[model samples]
Target: MSRNPRILVTGATGRLGRLLVPRLLARGAHVRALTREAGRAASLAADGAEVVVGDLGDGASLRHAFHGASHLFLLSPISPELAAEQIAAIAAAKAAGVQRIVKLSGSHWTIEPPGRSLSGDAHAHIEAALRASGIAHQVLRPNAWLQVTLARLAGELAAGDVLHAPPAFPKVAGIDARDIADVAAHALLGPEPSATDSPWVLTGARAVDHHEIARIASALSGRRIVAEPLSREALAQRAAQAESPYVAQVHAQFAALIGTGEAATVTDTVERVLGRPARTIEAFVAEALAA
Candidate 1:
């Protein structure tokens, strides 16, 4: 893509969007950041992005945002109908003559165990939409966020000595959100050629289980920690009590995955994309514990 092309970024007010917009601007791309809440678009405006009020569910709004845009950064939020929302947005982008789209598809979760499940189904629909639109696109499937470990292990980290849930042997290939954002930004503004349409999987440097994370946190904080396991049913009940139906469902699914140890495999996808090793769990633990 040319430098300073009119680029439209959906979900610009989100976590990745916040970083992605600024990164694109640093590459000299003029951006229109689309958000459902106009007030929250202030950050984008401050970062030299043209803020547009819009929703993925509304075709007219998406059309308006896609207008006069050459490249589109399509980031569908985590939801059951992510694919449908993305397809609608892609249709609008095609009508607006957009040339490129960078989409955040499924995670390592879906990639490792491909099926007709919710996450997989949603990503499939999005890919279908991009293909049907005949738009040049890149699909990124990242691994589970390191934040998941941080979120669950925060209390332990703060106290400087405990593993809140999961057995010590439970392993996961945890990735940092910032790294994922970097890869997304790189793909959005990087050189494109015959290799533009391939699917890229983003990941952190290493695969780590709770025991390793606990050890890292211990080293970082200079304290001893005890790893403890929680039952899947208990975690699900806790999630349900927290009033997050979606999280409850995910927790139950995760419990099943954990039982099968299907989440243990690690991939070299991040190295292929970024031309370097991904961040390690130790780095994540140190960074998150400090935060």
Candidate 2:
């Protein structure tokens, strides 16, 4: 890596990438954010990041984006092709002489031995590729996101006082997306590279169930908000509305893992990496409400 690394970031328009890009820029790194649409990256280009429009499925675009990059921060949308696309990205990075990479991966709860979620299986395959590629890399396995898990409930609260939660584990320690972004920035810009063998698992400071989340919302909104469990039919409809067949399968797999023990464990990885306690659910809800 050069004294000043030029970092190429994929999924730059998504929630986590939007947060990570500015953090990398603040650290004086040369940030090149990739998007498939030129128009979507207009703001990124305006934010002093070198925005490149590319697709993981498109090799010419990947080559163009990988040119002269010292490191790659890889993230892809949820799809069945995730493993193949990311593996190809690693190969392209190596061919471009990019020596280091950081990958945002699926949390442990979503994973199983095999034939589970496409999301989990994809991450496992890509992680294996990273090991075989010999790239200086670190994988971050972030737990359930507050933004994805609860922000919708908060948004729904604006219209009604009830949250229709699907069946899930009793208590889940969901981490904030901001915390994950911070860990990613550290992994990418730290003084030295982390071992590729071990993945960093991220979680929030505490675990809380849907009922507890309702209480928090009630407390924050100063109104009575209830968490009503979604019926199996409603849940089935929700899964049916997924964007693709592969994603629908992934959602079904996720639904199957809801009652497992893995979803409730909390880790100190965030505090260890950033030297501060992890962000809390209350804070995440407050921010969601404010937004």
Regions of candidate 2 where Cα sits further than 4 Å from its true position: none
Query: For residue 210, what is the lDDT in candidate 1?
Result: 70
Best by lDDT: 2
Instruction: Name the candidate that leads on TM-score.
Output: 2
**Whole-model lDDT for model 2 versus the true structure?**
0.86
lDDT of 2 by residue, 156-204 (tens): 7777888877676367888999999999999999855656348888899
Q: Which 10-residue window of candidate 1 scores lowest in summed lDDT?
A: 111-120
